[model samples]
Target: MDNFSFYDLQPKISNFPDEVLAGLSKQQKQIPPKFFYDEYGSKIFDQICELEEYYPTRTEFGILQQHSSDIADQIGENSLIIEYGSGSSQKICFLLDSLIKPWAYMPIDISREHMLSASKTIADKYPNLKVLGVYADYTTEMLLPEYAISSVQKKVIFFPGTTIGNLEPEEAIQLLKRSAMIVGSCGGMLIGFDMKKDPQILHASYNDSKGVTAAFNINLLTRINRELEASFDTNTFTHYAFFNPQKSRIEMHLISLVEQTVVISDRLFNFLEGESIHTENSYKFSVQEIENMSERTGFKLIRFWTDPKKHFYPG
Candidate 1:
């Protein structure tokens, strides 16, 4: 048995630099998107996955169930399976089970607990499968561990869950380019993208009536308070999300319910009543856009499948 070391992806800001802190304080209310993955936030997200309105997880999993054999056939043998944001390794099991043979399984994630838990489960179920879990964020520039994969084998990057939507166009392209460099010339990439659809359908998916998404969004502040020793009134903030047609994204925000001042260590920040801080934007993509992105980024579009009901684009 191999002993796995735990890692955290948090940026080490020893001194919350005055200028940067001041800039953040200038906003009536402000919170960065990175704070959204505390243990509580991750648990809430798992709840959101079970929600009826949240369709991406279920729809994408369904597509995999139906076409896993075909997808596995295309991937072929002796390729290392690498997944981005591989949490719990739940959805991935479908594909791996269907594959005839694979050299290794590398799941990259930001959470050390998830990486360890998921990797252990996979290792237990598939005795012969080599499992390597990387505790790092693949979105940013970082050197991947050399031992994670064999230099001689073909690489296949599995970036499912419409995660590309989290990035802007340029960032998405850069990620794809990185994938190209990692996989080399002979390999392929499989990914998922939520397709453009009716405004109502798209809007309802994120801003569900049960408000689980809202809880998850606001939970980011709670994480910041706990991790950074900051004082934030979680009850004084509310979550807001809307479809921005101009940007073609679902923008999420945390609006202050009342004016207040929060202190973090030595700095004091003030917020105006009803003001908002932008948290994240999830950009959806058209099929053509996805294909073009792949082409421009040096990956030929292998094959993509969508549910017959038109909910998502799974490849």
Candidate 2:
């Protein structure tokens, strides 16, 4: 297999954090979710997947293991497989084994190092396959690769790992719309979504016994301190993740233990006592909720497979 052509290895200039920060100043408080996938963040998240309490990965993988053949048949042969957030490319083998003859593989992610390493491994393993590695932040507005964008035929869009949970409802819809436009109506999308579960279960997934999730959450602050020259007391903050039943999602944040002032680039920022910086949200969906979501986004549910024991509720 040869390395495939990429749309754009570098992100568009306007996608820089300085641009984002300037834009966010117009709002009360804001943080774009793309920062969560820096190298360290990605590693910590991989640790999160290995924890006993995190059931989404195991359950979703089980469903794929059981129904890859069916899924492949539905997707058909000679189709291009484009995956979003293609971390490690761990799950692609199962689908590739089933598909047997895919036209190309496009793996997109913000972590260029990981994407580069994983894409190389994938190409080596899947001889005769065209593998294109894209290092772009899909959350930010950027032009897709010309080849993919200009293709008259639609290709399959694969968004696994339940990363869709990171998006707000409206954002998720907009993302799907962008994907649909890229793939067109002829190409379909296959996604994995974590189902809603008990608050205890949800919270434990992010605050596991190993504390890897906690480390991952705290690493965000560490990253800002290092990169943006912001002062963040990691020890003074604690990670918190809990299911909001009403919102049908698990919200993750770092709560400040006391009032504090932090300096960044010669500017001081105040934090009130017991205040928190909301970091991430993992929205867990019911089957009906996903079905409604699919319908609203002009996606017809082709098939949904799940491991019921893991509380998998695919639609």
Candidate 3:
């Protein structure tokens, strides 16, 4: 396994309790979407990507397939590709297949088990390429392994999933700034973002006809209950999702069907009937918005591309 290695910057579930408690304590009870990737949660999300109504994954992949070589040319030879929230490792295959000679691949994720598994699979496929699985929150400030940087001719962050939509603009800027730290002075980021499109399309994607999206939303509660010793009657909560056109984002929430109190580690939290715990936000952006984000974060937005239908884009 010389070509493969994994590093855990944070211990297993180390900050889960504190983060959960903090999020629940808010006036508008909310949980960070990052918590949605414990091993089981990660697998559930992979299912989410394949749902017929969920269009981002496939649309982004098409864009990559159409322009991977062009994208690879920009990335150049002997480069490093570090994916943010590296789930499943499916989409990166297109770019890797087209690249000249990628020196290394770093899949950074909060879920250690998921990241390690994905990295190993990738390493097995690309024997000549170095695979470094980094188990850490990419949003948190950190660096690539000191040893990984010296020989890489170019460093590019391959953020393919529009996961950046999960954060608020301020938080997104902070993350990009931290990423700037890893890629160094000349490094760049290639990211995906859904543009502001039909609100109904946005609504349908998150509120899929199949119940898989519901399960994915509820799994967050299941994780809290299992890992934090909470008593959450999962059946009493219904999955709710909709597009908020004003904000240009889809918001997912778990609505309490009945008034109840849940206890986690002896901490009591009460819920009113119909009240909701906000779970996630997926923001849609226009090209100018992405360019503005790059400018704010000190990274220049070099180029952008989209599918034939223009449903999704990567820049």
Candidate 4:
């Protein structure tokens, strides 16, 4: 446990309320996807990865399992590993196992409890590795841990689970550029990409039959009700997700079952029947788009590996 350190940089409580009010005030009601990671939401998302319809997680896992040795060869030895949105810390284990004498592991996530628990577990399992759990929204500008800067030989960012797909292309470029700055000129990044696939497959991934995806989507409202004192009737709002071909993405929205008004901290928001609050967008990519993004973001596409069916890419 001495090898592990935890840092909390999550936003103040008032930040959520402010963001929600501003988003709801928009002509197109929207909520930032960051809100979907409250403790409960984080647990629900772990369940989502195991669903049969969700192929990205398992597919990417397979790609890593098959090519980890080659990937490790590229990353080199004694490198610092920084994982963004490090939920559950499952994939990092494989990379750590394959890498030669990885100097440290830093798992950055918004959920404090989840980040701490996962970091501690990784530390216990790899007693020789330094584990630092950072509680911050990696999507925003963040100061990397001072110790990670001075103690490690090289930095390698492991951003798996296609989480980058959540951002628009421009936002993705900005994030990659930030990551490049964090790792410095000598560092490299191994990122996962969810490839463009059949619309049916994309739709099924977000709309699982067991309703776990629905539950995961609805957990956002439950979080708002609990944390913001928002009067959101969970039963009156249903989860809806679909692939938008024009956008090359899957959009998750919460649709109102009836006309209603909800009050959050003295702020009132109204919704008509069938009106939806846009929650998340997951953008799929092509190889060409990824190459273009990498070029714009200051990263050279040194290598990439995909699953047998080519559903996912880890590069």
Candidate 5:
């Protein structure tokens, strides 16, 4: 029988209003990209991955399919796979299929309901595998279940999907260092990096023809409306995504179509016409940059695999 345990570190009611107000108050208004996963946002993202223009998910999966055996060999046996921002827990299935007696799977994420649902589904499929769901923002320091820490032969951090690109370089370095600590000396990390690519290709990935990406971006505001009792005319906000070559990032923003004021729990935030709230930034990296980052964070990259077209890398 598979045993599943869920830990709720995120509040039942999100602190999103506080985050929203703080971001809105900034000189250059911006919200953290992590805020995009409130149930609805998460579902929209799953759809975005299936879009023809969105290649990262598919590209990464191909690399995993071709290299899972090799990756499993490198990972060795009796390992505990801890995934940050586990999302649908789909990609890890490939790794789990290849790993030799992986003792447990710990999926840490901020979306409690989604994480629990995925964890249960994964448990059902991997009947002998232990699934522990930690409901907390993985960006912050987290406490792993005592059993996960004490019983595992090896602790491998499986951070796929190139999610690390969402963080600034400095923040990414810190997170890598933290993961190194959690995995301890004997363990290794298998991560994915979205390689730098043509600006046109990058632009199309975030601005799909079906406008699923736009809906995904706008859903953040809808989340605020539902959770914070905010009056946000979501229709009045347009989704905008563009590649900033200078910064080597894809920036997504919600542009206010008209001057408006939104109220959340007695607090008022005013937006002028054309004003935008920066929602997310996906940074692209070079192979050299990934090597340098791993070196700086004390991880020795044993191997890296990428598609023939070099669209994405899973190492």
Candidate 6:
């Protein structure tokens, strides 16, 4: 088990019933998008990432490949990279290859199997490199081990993907501030932020013609039924996603096809035929917005990488 550095995930699971109940009790029924990553959901997401309409994964990967050296330059040597999500992809591979003498790599995730598998694979690939995988929900406040890139050394937080965009601006700022505390004042954070772009493109990304995104979205309900013992007729709901141009964000919802009632945790809930449960949001930002976020969060904007169209940037 030492090879994987696994952490207990039951506490996180224990909170799931309450969290799901809390989100569902509100006037606008909801479920935090975090719940969308159960094993099946995670597998569906991998399929979504490969869809022609889902450009974030490939586009962001290009940025990593193109700017690896420049990013490694900022990170320098003997650094510890604390990645907020599973680094099973090539993003961390590129970073490790470019950086000189990185002290260790810590990749955190809510899935224990995912964290341990990724950690073990990375350890196997780089026999001399230290890969510590922590299984925990990174969205909430986190206190990593003291020796995990301690104050005596250089540390960098690499948060890849458009996950930052998944949070409201206020929540995003608070999360960045927490990241600041984790890395200390001297550390740097290389994060990903989607950019405001054509509404049509944004719409297509989340509402792919192939319906993979739809399956990925509805998987939340499937997860609820399986884990929380909820009565969600997944087939009675439809995946709905659209771009909110004014908010510079994309919203995902599951609209009930007909009036129905479901029970969760021994409580009853009613839904109208047209009722919706807002599930997730992807807020796109401009360069100025990201810079402002850094300023508000006690950090400074360093280098950034983006495609010519500015569809996305993860630096």
Runs with alpha carbons beyond 4 Å of true place in candidate 1: 2-23, 26-30, 147-151
Cα lDDT tens digits, model 1, 1-315, are: 453333344523333234226546664444445567667887898999989888999999999999999999999987888889898899889988998778888888876677889888888888887787777878877566666544546788898997889887899999999989889888888898988888788788889999999999988777667766888899998988889998889888888899898787678877788778777778988878888998899988878778998778766
Candidate 4 residue-wise lDDT, 182-232, digit = tens: 988889899999999999999888999999989988988888888888999
Per-candidate TM-scores read 0.89, 0.89, 0.92, 0.92, 0.92, 0.92
Which lDDT tens digits does candidate 3 get at residues 1-315? 789988877735547799889999998999888778777876888888898988998899889999999999988988889998886788889999999988899888876776788899999999998998998877777756777777775799999877789889788889888877778777788888888888888888898888888998899999999988899999999999988878888999999999999999999999999999999999999888888888888888888889877788888
Local distance difference test, candidate 6: 0.84
User: Which lDDT tens digits does candidate 2 get at residues 46-90?
Assistant: 778878998888887888888899889988878888888887898
Worst 10 residues of 6 by lDDT: 2-11
Models ranked on lDDT: 4, 5, 3, 6, 1, 2
Candidate 2, position 231, lDDT: 82
Backbone clashes in candidate 5 total 0
Error of 5 at 59 (Å): 1.1
- Stretches of candidate 5 exceeding 4 Å from the true structure: 5-14
**Where is model 3 more than 4 Å wrong at Cα?**
8-14
**Highest-scoring model, lDDT:** 4
Error of 5 at 299 (Å): 0.7
Error of 5 at 15 (Å): 0.8
Q: Which candidate comes out best when scored by TM-score?
A: 6
Q: Write the per-residue lDDT of candidate 6 for residues 114-221, one digit (tens) a residue.
A: 677778888888876777778777778766766564634788888989999899988898899989888877788989888888888888999898999999988899
